[model samples]
Target: MGKAAKKGIFLTTSRFSHEAEDYVKGLDAKIILIDGERLAELMVEYNVGVDPVATYEIKKIDSDYFL
Candidate 1:
């Protein structure tokens, strides 16, 4: 995949160095850099490698319904 690939995703548990970040800016394709913190956030957000422990919903008295 040469010119056909216009976008890419790079995931790392650590981080991207300043030089590595700067290099992608000059490239023809778009590159997304995901660091450790963000990777964890995305994993939780998308339910990847995770399990739902508990969920709760709050309810209030409906005066209109009572009336």
Candidate 2:
């Protein structure tokens, strides 16, 4: 783990639980735990191993628009 950390290999797993998260938080190495949902979201966000077929524009509500 120390060697991997020194080499800048960021470890990530989707099987992290609350206890595991707490344990990893105490480690000196860089580790990221992406749960199932977040992993899916990231895959979609980065287009990893998947192709995006459509795009959408999202708009936020502006208070000034009503004023």
Worst 10 residues of 1 by lDDT: 1-10
What does the lDDT read for residue 1 in candidate 2? Answer: 78
Model 1: per-residue lDDT, tens digit, 1-67?
3668889999999999999899988888989999999999999999999999999999999999978
Query: In order, what lDDT does every prediction score?
Result: 0.92, 0.71
Give a tens-digit lDDT track for model 2, residues 29-65. 7666677777777888898878978989999999998
TM-score of each: 0.69, 0.55
Task: Flag clash pairs in model 2.
Answer: none
* Segments of candidate 2 deviating more than 4 angstroms: 2-15, 55-67
